[model samples]
Target: MTPSQIAAFCLQLPGAREDLKWGSNRVFSVAGNKMFAILDFLDEGRGGLAFKVDSDLFLGYVDRPGISPAPYLARAHWIALQRPYPMGAEELRAALTRSHQLVVARLPKRLRLGLLLDPA
Candidate 1:
């Protein structure tokens, strides 16, 4: 999916917000602090997208075409899809939703409760 599409999908999740970092990369985070997805836009051309995954999913995805461990965050079970992503729009959106859930689950109980009550 395009970066704009990814951003749109990610924002559909509870408390999801987009932040720009390293100038061009769009970072999607929930519950105020934790990030679940990133869309990297390079000066030369379109860049890849990265998100967190479970260990089992990480292993399975890394072995697939166009998928790899995310730079600097692989040890935490994050994965990246190279530019010209192999997955379809729906698949990418599902992954982003799951990643957002995973991050939200790790958030403080009070904050998580607030998000659930009012996911603005």
Candidate 2:
């Protein structure tokens, strides 16, 4: 997906918010400050995208063309897409949704319940 489409998708997730960080990078987070995805506008050519991935699948994802371990965050099982074309748009959306869920699952019980009850 294009950057704007990706941004819109991320923001539609329950309690998800976006912030511009490190100048041109757009950071998407849930439950106040736990980031689930990031879009780097400064990358040459098409922007770069990164998101959390299931730990067991991290290595497998990074082995794919155009996918790499996210800088400084890979140890936590995050993967960066140098270009969004490595996966189809629908697959990218599914991965983004999974990333959001994974981050939400790690949040405190009360916060998760609040998100479910009132996503505004």
Candidate 3:
């Protein structure tokens, strides 16, 4: 998916927001604190996307074409594109949504509740 489309999907999650980080890269985080995804535009129709993923499913993705363990974050169960991603847009969107939920789930119970009650 295009970066804009991916960003739009990420922002649809509760408490998700965008921030620029690591120079030109764009990051998506929950509750303005925990990051779930990152986008780096390489050229027209080509870019890198990375996100947290379930430990159980991590190996399966990494074995697939164009998927790899995310730099620095892979030890924590994150997956990244080995190149400008080559995959179904829907699958990426679903992964983005799941990544957002995973980050949200790890928030402190009180904080997660607060985010859910008032996502603004």
Candidate 4:
């Protein structure tokens, strides 16, 4: 997927919101404020989308072509999936869902429950 395609995919998630925190680089975060996707590739040359993932799962995608640990966030569980991959839109959407799920799982129970109850 191209940069715009990736951003669009991220936006398809429930209550997903975009913030251009890093200048014009759009960051896709959850309703509860957890970041699950970073659509920085649009303005940052050689940029890629970052998704939260477990180490083992991170390694799986990292070993694949067009995917790697995000530059600075690798140790903290972030993976960069480049465009032009063979993965389809549904697959990417599922990955983003999983990413959001992982983040939600790590938050406090109250916060997680609050997010679940949010209408957004």
Per candidate, the number of residue pairs that clash is 0, 0, 0, 0
lDDT of 1 by residue, 1-120 (tens): 777777788888878888888788888998666989888833223768889997788999999998988888899899988778888888887888888878887887888888782323
Q: After superposition, how far is residue 5 of candidate 3 from its true place, in Å?
A: 0.5
User: Where is model 4 poorest over a 10-residue stretch in terms of lDDT?
Assistant: 111-120
* Cα error of candidate 1 at position 82, Å: 1.9
Q: How does candidate 1 score on lDDT? A: 0.81
* Regions more than 4 Å wrong, model 1: 41-45, 117-120
Listed in order, each prediction's TM-score against the native is 0.89, 0.91, 0.87, 0.78
lDDT of 2 at 3: 83
Off by over 4 Å in 2: 41-45, 117-120
Ranking by TM-score: 2, 1, 3, 4
Clashing pairs in 3: none
Answer with 2 or 3, whichever has the higher TM-score: 2
- Residue 50 CA error for candidate 3 (Å)? 0.5
Q: Which 10-residue window in model 2 sums to the lowest lDDT?
A: 111-120
Model 4 accuracy (lDDT, Cα): 0.72
Better of 1 and 4 by lDDT: 1
Which numbered prediction scores highest in lDDT against the true structure? 2
TM-score winner, 3 or 4: 3
